[model samples]
Target: MTKDSSPTQLTHFDQQGQAHMVDVAAKQDTHRTAIACGVIRMKAETLAIITEGTAKKGDVLGIARIAAIMAAKRTSDLIPLCHPLALTRVHVDFSITTETNTIQCQAQVETVGKTGVEMEALTAVQVGLLTIYDMCKAVDRGMVMSDIRVLEKHGGKSGDWVSLIDQQDHN
Candidate 1:
């Protein structure tokens, strides 16, 4: 964004309000990374079943990890006006919070490209959490997936940005 640009400006739209993909042909390819997070809050028993590997669907985290990686690669197909990035790395991790009865999903995506991978990271986290929900829905359909957002992004023309919540989490 420039000095005259508003933060609310939708970059995906043209002046005529027609949707289009942002052109990155002029932008230099740089090593970029993004991290996104989401949490799926479920019943305690549901969490226990997943953590104890007793779910009928087999390994929850393993399946979710694979699903997240595939989602990252397919983000361009699912979302409009997104560049198909050649991501070099995609890592999906999960943490089970027994006390909170939640499963936290995080996806860190790295790519050497002209555009940012924030959308890819976000998509990965969401799909990963959704996979968990899908595999465990038989046990807990009421599971709530929330707080899905990009926690941080690095290596862009505008430099790096980190969410305040993520900064507070580090402290």
Candidate 2:
């Protein structure tokens, strides 16, 4: 309930009650990269249908990949207070684990900027997962979105981080 208690909330607003972008000008520009991931769990049969191009939607993985890339490019437009960044590269890949009947969506975003690209990486996951859900919903209505999280972030003064999930076997 207090500003000091919530660090995230404290840095998000300004004195006049108007939302403002955090001033990162003083911070040194560094090569930054963020890796984020999420899982879409569903029936094994449904996963097979998608992987085999049997779904009515057509090329589910391709569409999701494009959506993720586009989402990363448009992060600043979608999220207020985020700086527009020129990302050097954005890669979104899906690991279809047949054994688990889950699609692991991973988005890696890189940039040379004052601020980190964690939000961009996260936005890519959200939009990519949504696209997968949209394309496959006709076949599996019970699909669940879970395990959405940042797997790692590197560069900047914070140095490097590897998410807990990555430390554990994704199995």
Please give the lDDT score at residue 126 for candidate 2. 87
Among all windows of 10 consecutive residues in model 1, the one with the lowest summed lDDT is 1-10
Model 1 per-residue lDDT tens digits across residues 33-141 = 9999999999999999998999998999999999999999999999988899899999999998899999899999999989999999999999999999999999799
Give the runs in model 2 whose Cα sits over 4 Å from its true position. 1-9, 15-18, 168-171
* TM-score result, candidate 1: 0.94
In terms of lDDT, the best-performing candidate is: 1
- Which 10-residue window in model 2 sums to the lowest lDDT? 1-10
Clashing pairs in 2: none
Model 2: per-residue lDDT, tens digit, 7-77?
35667667767777887877898999999999999999889988899878789999999999999999999
